[model samples]
Target: MTQTVMHLDDTDSLERFDAALDALEGHLKRVFADDSAEADRAVLAALQEQVRVLTEERDRLLTDLEAERARVQRLKEANEEVSGRLEGVMGALKDMAPALQD
Candidate 1:
């Protein structure tokens, strides 16, 4: 048994996919140059639908990525604020410690 893994960052795979799509499109054009075959039209329609679905998915992923980035930025800001407050409290405690020792 063999398992295959794909990564989003695999540019070579993406390039190959694109090349394959291009080749398929060229072949279809040559086969259906007369534009009268119902089967060819159906295949082209299916391909276009697939492209639309992929485009929608890409848009959704981009939107999700932007939202995640915004959330991360907000979390970083909150962490910094908490850290500053903690430092201030520590400083106040240190000041009171010296007074108590006296």
Candidate 2:
């Protein structure tokens, strides 16, 4: 049998994943409930392969997200440092203006 491909979003939740799996299982059960041996084998093989690919893709995205979160946290720290320097500069300017007016 030819492979069937699905385009699933990377951010799907565990509940959603479970539901999708359950749905496919129910569909297969209904479709193959009194079918010949050949059809039952085909359905089982297709489900196995599809589940493998989907789980792999989901794992990859979660790994990528963790890496991205770390990068964003570093950036946030850098921005805080810059903001502190700008505040200091503004304070210094404020002090200098009062002295100049004397």
Candidate 3:
């Protein structure tokens, strides 16, 4: 059976992940309920492999999320520094405004 791959890159990723897990669990239950022992064993092995792959994907996504969060923090700090310097420059310009007017 061909399985569909879902990318978990958005805000609803957790929900999608849960749904995928549930689907896998349902399939496992159906396999156990089946009377064909050999076929069920094969299906079970395949399902186990899919679970392993999904777990690895989840770990990779978590690592990516951490890196993205760090990047955002760095950007925020840089933006604040730039904003402060711009405010200081504007204040200096205001101080020179009266002299220029006179």
lDDT of 2 by residue, 15-102 (tens): 5876786687677666667565466587687886787787786677678767866876999999999999999999999989989999
lDDT by residue for model 1 over 68-97, one digit each (tens)? 668769999999999999999999999899
Model 1 lDDT on a 0 to 1 scale: 0.71
Error of 1 at 75 (Å): 0.4
lDDT of each: 0.71, 0.75, 0.80
TM accuracy, model 1: 0.61
In order of appearance, the predictions have TM-scores of 0.61, 0.63, 0.68
Clashes of 3: 0
User: CA lDDT of 30 in candidate 2?
Assistant: 69
Which parts of model 1 are misplaced by more than 4 Å? 1-39
Worst lDDT run of 10 residues, candidate 2, spans: 3-12
Best by lDDT: 3
lDDT of 3 by residue, 19-39 (tens): 887788787777778777556
Clashing pairs in 3: none
